[model samples]
Each structure stands twice: as structure tokens, then as C-alpha cells.
Target: MASLDDLPLRADLVGRTPYGAPQLDVPVRLNVNENAFPIADVVADDVVAAVREAIAGVHRYPDREFTELREAFAGYLGHGLDASSIWAANGSNEVLQHVLQAFGGPGRTLLSFSPTYSMYPLLAQGVGSAYVAAPRAADHTLDAATVTAAIEEHDPDVVFLCAPNNPTGTAMGLDVVEAACDAARGMVLVDEAYAEFAHDRSQTALSLLGRHERLLVSRTMSKAFAYAGVRVGYLAADPAVIDALRLVRLPYHLSALTQAAALAALRHAPTMLARVDELRAQRDRIVAELGRMGFSPFPSDANFVLFGGVADPHAAFEGMLADGVLVRDVGIPGTLRVTAGTPEETDAFLASVARLAPSPRP
Candidate 1:
């Protein structure tokens, strides 16, 4: 008998692997770009009360259709989206995986821009699809020409775009997204996990849903709503796409408790939006301070900013960690991405950076 490790594994997975971000135990955690604020005490109590009310029904199976939660999400977004046009999963991450499973497979291709959310390619590979990326311009702007060229060349089965993209924080305009949707031969997925912080109107790819049968918009409550722990996210698309996702997803994928929590959170979305405004103001202040300190962070429409052209980004990352600050080293040479924390946390991070005495590399 051959050893399990020695035996030949799936050929496709030889070098392919799982995805994760760095986790560090630090006081001021600015990594992962999570909403720095916790759910308000009153709101949290409401969620707790809702969960307790549903706890008695634990023996019963969850709502396989997740209808109530879907309706709540639609109400929260201020869209008259019907349950038929919405689908929910454990998280937007799972929602993304379901999309890949439904559309991506052997011989198919998944397309996205380089230095994106990082999960796009990983999800594509998980479903046995080839992943391709076209690099964004130096300032992290999506190059319509490059994207158009790639679509013409690969003709991918699915294209993923992260708006106010992670690690870069640049938002794509409506025209650029329309161009990609027009060029796509199969499906176009626009991930809007950070849209609330954008300070601009969301050019939801949903607007193109009718015109382009292949468009899907994925959203999450994790960032804007501060419900990361609840693990609920949704996708909006045509009914046909929603049906396909439902078919692929596990029945009862979202727990009854999760549904209740999500609904409660949605009811308070206006309050959450007010909190988002505070976070955005803090983010702007941090970005401006960084510029004054000689760090060139790209103009961001998201909660985090990516600064680069440093002499040693990793070193800076380590230094910040040592000073009790935690951020992500996204491996874009000379660039470190930091999430905007509370005002005090922001000041602490700035002070730590000042202590590093960083000098820009020419």
C-alpha cells in the first residue's frame, strides 16, 4: 500500500491550493478590512433576542428556501427585488463558490483583474476552471482596453470584478463595467463587498441584468453592516441565474438563526449606514495623513487604502505589528494595505508609522 501523501493526487490540484489571509493577534487590528465597530449593544441585544426566539425550533430543519431573509435583504437595499431574483448562502464567499460551481468547470475559464479580492481565482480553481488575470494600470484603475483584449483572447466562461476592489480600493465606473459585460461571452460577476464605503453611487451591475443575461452582482453585510460573524450574504441576478444558484447550493445552507440575525440587521441598515459614514470620514482623514507623511496611497473609495513605493513594505508591516498594529501585507512589492479602524485606532496606527521613520524608495 502506498502512503497517502505519496500516492498521486488530483492532477489539477498538484500546485493549486486553499485561500486565506494572514491572522495576527494584535491590539489594533487593521487587517482583513473588517468594519472596526462592533454591532451596537442595542442591535446586538435584538439579534440575541431573535436567536433565542428561534432556538426552540432547533430540532426542525432550517427554511431550505431562505425566503424571509431574502426579502429582508431586498428591503434593506431599497430595491424592489423579489425573492426569485435573490439567493442567500452561509456567506458571500459561499455564494461566490456556488456561482463558480454552476458556471466553471474543466475546459472553461474564469477571468478577473490582477490584485483583486484574491478569492476570485481561488474559487475558480476550486471548481476545476482555469484562472486568468489582466493587470490594472499603475494607479489601480481598471484599463478598459486591457480588459476588452483579455475577453477577446480568452473568452472566459465567468468574469469576476471586485468593485472598490480589495487591496487597491479603486472603484470601477458604470461605463467600464458595461464594457466588460458587453464583451463577456458567458457570465460577469461584480463583487460589491465594499460598496458602502465608496462615497459614490453603486453602478450595480444589476442594472445590466436585463440587457446582459449573464450579469450577477454579489453583496455582503460583513463590511458595511458589520455582520461578519453572522455569515450571510446575497447575490442578485436574473431569475434564471438565481434558479441555477439555488440548484447548486445545499438545501438549508443558511441556518434559521442566521436568517433571523440577518433580518434584524437589515431592519437597522439605516443606522448601519450612519456608522459607515463615520468610518468613511475616518478613512479619508487617514489617507490624507498618509499622503502628508510621504506615503503615496491610491485614491480610495473603500474603507482601506493601499500604499506602495516604499523601500520595504514587509519590513514596515512587521514594524507596525511589533508596535501592536495589525495590517495586511498583500505582497504587492512596496505596498501594505491597512483598514480604517476607530479614530483612536487610526491615530495609534499613524503614530506607529511615524515611529518607523520610513523613507520612500526612489
Candidate 2:
């Protein structure tokens, strides 16, 4: 029973808390923005076979570079990327960790706009880098001018742009991304963890990669690929960037089973992604329903919607939980976020919230 204070810990982490979201056991779980559908049986069988092959050699360490997985990832991305230009790890969080470890340090700073993925600042701090936040537009938009001006002011060594951003589920325009890259004197990291769920795939920062060596686009199989349980996330960037990441990545960081499973998932990428349209339909339904109910649901390009006008977000969240539907109260006052789950799950959530009859914020 030793307290953290009793041990020698990093001074910066002394007062910080771990990133946590409710993992409640509920009949209708929508707190996290996960793909509601399970992997198809055929694909699941392929995964089983691939993993079985991996197990036969699990006694030894996996390929340190995860060559095959990287190749499969590049093929899936399909922007003429090769294995040398790709890198991956346990999850998108780890991909960010690698970026921070490679480019961030005590004297460097990591900057981003506010109301974005909550983990960016923490990731910077974890790597002993200074963190700075600039407020987004009043309407929760990130325009080129705003991002460029902030880049000039902060002069950070790294910048993080979360497209199809978490919490609010807004996407960054290509203009903003290009401007941010041009303005930054250092690395520009575009986190597209929810890219596959975007309304327009062409808006992704990946299209900017060939033009900017400093640009990096991070993605994950967790959300749209129904591979959250497999924990595979990746990035595409210049080969030099990938080389820098190799320096800090632990030897054999990815397990053989993980590599095998991810490769198998990539093989059946189309099938694994077949549920996206259904999920998008449900997402649109949620937004429209919320609007009709007198709430302000943000227009989302991701699988979840961040709706406002709740009298008390936490109260509404609790009410929903009481009825067995779990959603997130992302600490945005008078706002809450819910994933676009199955039709039945969505119906249950809508019914539960309708029962509460929560009023809009004035």
C-alpha cells in the first residue's frame, strides 16, 4: 500500500490524473465511439487462421519492424505508400506516443486547438514536452487563418490536428491542414483516427503527404474496421519520420499475434468496413432526432454526435444510464456525446432520453 507520493515520480505527473472514460456494463453501450457491428463470420474465420499461424511461432519475438503488417497497412491506405513510409503499434495512442517520443522533449512544445481529443496535451506532457492550447472558432471550427496564427504565436515544435475530431466530431478542412503545415516550422501531425467514418474521404490530410515532408497522418483500425479488440493503429509519413520513430520504439513492440491478426483484418478490409454506411445512417438519424427534440447536435463526420442544449449534461447522462444506455458527458457544459450504434440500441437510447424530456440550454 504505497502512495504515488512516496515514490520518486515525474514532477509533471505529480498532480495529473489518468485518462479515463466510463466503462459501465449496460445493455445499450454507446459511451465510446466504437463500430457497433461485429466482424463478419468469414473475416473472423480468416483472423482465426492467421492468429493460429502466429501462435505456432509465438515462442519467439515478433518481427521488430512488423514488415508484413506495415505492407498490408500501406496497401489498405492506397496512396502509393510503401512499408518504409508506414509505422504502427498497439493503438493510435501508441502511434502518438512514438511521434512525441521522436519529436517532443523537455524544451519543445506541442500545440493544438482546444476542444479536441483530450489526450493530446497529456501525451505531450507524458513525453516531457510543453503543451499549449488555442481556442477554436466560436462555432467549433478550425480555419487556416486561426491555425496559422496560433502556429506563429506558439512556435511549437509539434502540432496536432485531430480530423473528424473526438468529443465534437467535426472535421478539418484541407485548407486549414495545408495552412497549418505551411506555417509550422516543425512537424505537423494530423490525427485521422476516425477518417474512415468521414463523410468525404478526400478531405483527409493524407492527400497532402506527397506535398509536405513534415506532414504525418495517423489512423486506426479500431473504429471503422471493428478491430478495437486487436489494438492496431498506424501512420503514413516520409520514410525519415518512420526512421525517427524506430529509434524510440521498443524492440519487437508489436506481438506476432497482433501483426497476424491485423494483416488478416486488412485482407478483408472491404468486408470489415461494410457496416460504415449503416453506422453513418444511424449517426445522421441521431443528429436529426436530437435537433427535432430541441437539442443542438453538432454536425458530425464521425460515428458519434456531440449534442448540446442539455440542462445538465451529467444529469441527462445519469438518467440514460439508469435506463441501461451509456453515453459520454465529455465535460462540455450542457453537452453530451453518444455513439451511433445499432438501430435497436439507438432506439433504446432515444427512448430513454425522450423519457427524461431534457430542456435545451438557454
Candidate 3:
């Protein structure tokens, strides 16, 4: 037998590590930007009933094409999209991976903004594509000129824009997004995972789909519908793009149980919208309180805030953890991201921050 140490591994995966969000057992958890609320009891009961109905046919394979769920999702969006233009996966994360796989590979490049979603880089690597980034301005906004210049220079095959981006919570303007889509020689993926919580209605790149054959808008149930554990996400694009994803995805990739649960949640979207509004209000309150306490919290349109400009971010993070509050210490040097939780959780977190406040030192 050959020695295990002598075996070769995929060269691209060498020295690459798995990606993850922090998991810590602490009170007042606010690390992940999960919907701070859970499914309402009425909605839960409906989902349970639907799942039970689905289980009655457990012996049969689920719809390999997920036609029913896709139609239901399209109806919920009411964005004038049809089933032919929609596709689903376990989560929006998977949807992103599928898009990268379909469009990216050797001799290709994936372009995005820096200090954005960390997963973009990992996804690019997974698809054997070179990843590149253009830094956001100090105000956390994209500079279209710089991005256009980079596109001209590198001529990447895919571009990813996370509206109301993760960690930083900054959203790109429509003009910036449109320009990026126009400049890209290949596909442009706009991730709207947090769009439901933004101040304005989601500016879906779907509107540009007619003119731009390479535009895809990705959305999720995890953040808005509080269905993270259920793991249902979908993408809206041109029928051709959706067909390409269907070609590569595993048949029956979406389980019957997930389909049923997602349908139930979509049926109760109004209730979910109410919860999102409440969380948005809570996030605003928390940001205001943090400001009052002398912390420079960035303006946010998502359910979390990225506050920094502090002298010792790690110390502040540790202090919060010591006080039994858990927030994300995004290693951006002197920055921390905190998800908006319930009123009680918010109070506890703010109290912890107050305790850490003192003579601010550089």
C-alpha cells in the first residue's frame, strides 16, 4: 500500500482552510445576524402540518426540479419573476456557490469589494478562480471609477456585490451596481441577503436582466423569514441562467421538508415583515445608545451595526464576553459587529458596553 503522507492532494486546496462564523456559549448572543425572533406559533404549527403532509410520501423522491417551491417563491416575491427565472438551494450561500461554479473556473477571476462578505473569497477558491477586491472608500461606499478601472485592468469573469453588505452593513447605490454589471465581461451576481432590512425597497438587479444577460439576484429566507435552520434560498435571473444552474445542481437538492416549510413561511410573509420592522427599530435604538456612550457606530441598513473607531476593539470585545454578552469580533482591526437582538438582549449588551467605557485611549 502507498504511504498516506506520499499521496497528493488538490493543489488549489493546499493551505486553504474552512470558513466559519464564531460559535460561543454566552448570554445575549448577537454574533450572527440571524433574525432575532423565531417563527410565530401559528406559523410553526402551519409548517409542522405541511411537513407532516410531505412525510406521508416519504417513500417517493422529492420533485427533482422543485417546481412547486420555485413557483411559490416566485409568487411571494411578486417581483414579476416566473418559475423559469428562479432556482433554489439549501441556502443563499449554496446559491452563491452554484453561481460561481457555473461561471468561474481556471483562467477566470471573481471580483468583489473588500471588507465585504468573507465567503466570496472562499467561494472563488472553491471554483478554482482568482479572487480580487477593490477597497471601499472611508465612508464604506464603493467608488465606481476605481471598480471600473479594476474591471478594465483584470477583466474578471464574475462580479459579486452584497447589498447592505455583511460585517460593514453598507449598501451600494443603484448606479454603482449597474455600472459594475455593464463593465463585467461575464456574470454579475448581486447578493441581497440583507435587502429585506434595508431602509429602501430592495433594488433588485432583476430589473436590469433584460439588458444585461449576465445579471443574477440572490435572496434568502434565513435573515428575513427567520428560517435559517430550515435552509431555503433562491436566485432570480434570466431563464437561461436558471437553466444553467439546474444543469449543475444535484437532483432533489431541496428536500420536501424544506419545500413545505418555505411555502408555509411565504404564506405568512406579512408576519415576518412585521418582525423585520421591529428588529430594524431595535437596531436603530442600539446604534443610538452606542453613540450616546461615545462609541462611533457606523450607519447601518441591516439588522446589525459595525461600530469601531475605538482604541482597543479586542479589549472591548473581550469585556463584552466577560460580561456574558457575545458579539462578533470581526478581525478587521479595531472593529466589532453586533447583531440586533431582543429588547432584553439589547439592554444587556448595551450595559456591557457601558461597563467597558472609560478613558478612551488610542
Candidate 4:
């Protein structure tokens, strides 16, 4: 068998690994930040009917523009957003990729804070853009001054701000977005994939859109919408931004069935989100219990908690896995991330952690 060395490949990607978390066959799986609840039966039935209707027309090409999906997304977002300002793709990851493809290329640069979504740098690399990571505060927080300073120093072509950030689950304030826009000479993309799970929705960067034409807020249905299986992610930005993305996205990228399923789920947005409160409660339980047990849990505005003070993250991960629960070891020293799923799943994870107590204090 010829190794990769024999085949011509992009030099930057020579030794890089694919982005993923372990998908083990564990009884209680809370590794990814997925919604713990399943879609409501009513919504599921609607989706089935929609898909059935859509399959009849699958012989024809899907709407290249995904007109209805964009409109549906606009209605769901509803902060004065319209279809002209919306863009959808397989997932938020793809949406971000589209942004980078249009704005970032060789010689251009992409910048973000450290310990953010692990995929940001990969997205930059896929576009042949240089990726620069600035450190966040000791507490994993990013203030306006820190962001502005980095923007000044790096002078990147694109800046990514992940709100309710992954791994740490720290939510950035709107002020940070405003300051970034004020300082950055390039486009600013705020990844709000977990916005719906935020403790306070008002802190969203969407409010800054009208004033800052260069600011774009991206969201995903995979998290709070409980529509991960459908693989629909969209963004709200200036109509011009949406227009730029159209130039790079493939023709008929979203299948008719995907459009149908996503539209059906969006119609019942309230019902689909009914379990958010329950999951939030479970998340709080994890934070409080971890602190009481002597672990340092970061304040999270997302579905997962990134707690520190572990003596050995790998050991805890293995011990938890041995007990039939799966969590994420994000390679952050003395830290691990676990999603807030069903009450039973939460109980199982808590029990495993209790058994693995006597961890090193931070």
C-alpha cells in the first residue's frame, strides 16, 4: 500500500488529523454538545410527512437557492432578518467554511481566541489562510480590549468569535463584537451555534448587525433545535455577505429532503425547543455538583460544562468510559468537557465522577 508520502497532497495538511471526538459505544454518551432530548413526536410526524412529500419531487433538482429554507430560517431568527440576509449549508462548520473561502485565501489571515471551537483553524487551513490564535484570559473569557489588541496586532482578513464557545462554554458579550468591529479592518464572524441555549438570549451579537455591515452571526440547528440528524445550519448577515457566499457554495448543495425536514422542524420551533429548560437545569446541576465536589467548573452559557482541577483528564476519561459513560477530553490541561443530556445520563456521569474523586485541586 502506498503511503500518503507517495501521493501529492497539500503540504499544510500532510500530518494533520481529521477533526473529531471519540465515538465510543458507551451506555451514556454525552461527549458532544448535543441536545439531550429527542424531537417531539408531533414535530417528528410533521418531518416524516414533509419528507414523504419531498421524495416525490426528488426526481427534479432541489431549489438551488434554497429559497424556502432561507425564508424559514429568517422567520426563525426574527431580529429583523430576511431571506436575502440568510445562508444555509450542511452545518455551521460548512457555513464558516464558506465565509473563509470567500474572504480568506493564501496571504490572508484568520484570527480567533484560544481554546475555542477546535475546527476554526482547520477551516482557515482548508482555505489556505494563515490561522492566528490569541490567548483568552486565565478564566477563558475574552473582553473587548483583548480582542481589539489582537485584531490590531494580527491585522487578519477574517476574525472568528465563538459565543457560548465550545469546550469552555463561555459566552462573549456584545461589547466584544462591537469593539472587534471597531478595531478590525476585515470581516468578523461570530459563531453563535449555542445561542439558543444561552442563559440570557439578550447578550446575542445579532443586535449589533444593523450598525456593523461587516459583522455576521452564524447559528446551527444541531444544538438547541435538536435537528442534528438533519444537518442544517444557517447564518444571518448583511445581504451582501449572503451574496458572496452564493458565489462559492455548490449548486443544489442542500437536498430537497434536507430542506423539507428542516422546514418542518422550523415550523414547530417552540415545540422543538421545549426541552431546553430541562437541559439547562441538568447543566446547572453538573456545574454546582462539580464545584461542591472540589472541581473548578467554568461558568457555562452553553449545553456543556468545561470543568478543570482534574489530576489526569485522560485517566478520568478512561474511568468514565469504563463505567459506560463517554465525555470529551479536549486536550486542555486539567480540564474535560461533558454535555448535559437526559437526567439519567447526567446521573450516570455524576456517579462516575464521584467514584473518580480525589482529583488534584487547581
**Index of the highest-lDDT prediction:** 4
Give the lDDT ranking, best first. Answer: 4, 2, 3, 1
For model 4, state the Cα shift of residue 33 in Å: 0.9
* Model 2 agreement with the true structure over 219-260: per-residue lDDT tens digits: 999999988888989999999999999999999999999999
How do the predictions measure up, each by TM-score? 0.95, 0.98, 0.94, 0.98
Candidate 3, RMSD to the unseen true structure: 2.5
Q: Give a tens-digit lDDT track for model 3, residues 61-170.
A: 89988888889888877668788888899999899999988999777899988889999999888888999987888767786786787788889899988888888888
Of candidates 2 and 1, the better by TM-score: 2
Task: Judge candidate 4 against the unseen true structure and give its global Cα lDDT, from 0 to 1.
Answer: 0.92
- The candidate, 3 or 4, that scores higher on TM-score is 4
Weakest 10 consecutive residues of candidate 3 by summed lDDT: 353-362
Candidate 4: tens digits of C-alpha lDDT, residues 177-266 = 999999999999999999988999888888889999999999999999998878888999999999999999998999999999999999
User: What's the lDDT for all of these models?
Assistant: 0.84, 0.91, 0.85, 0.92
Model 3, TM vs. native:
0.94
Residue range 25-138, candidate 1, lDDT tens digits: 789999888999998878888888999988989899988888888777766655557777888887899999999999998889999988888888778778889999888887
Clashes of 3: 0
Each prediction's number of clashing residue pairs:
0, 0, 0, 0
Evaluate residue 202 in candidate 1 and report its C-alpha lDDT on the 0 to 100 scale: 53
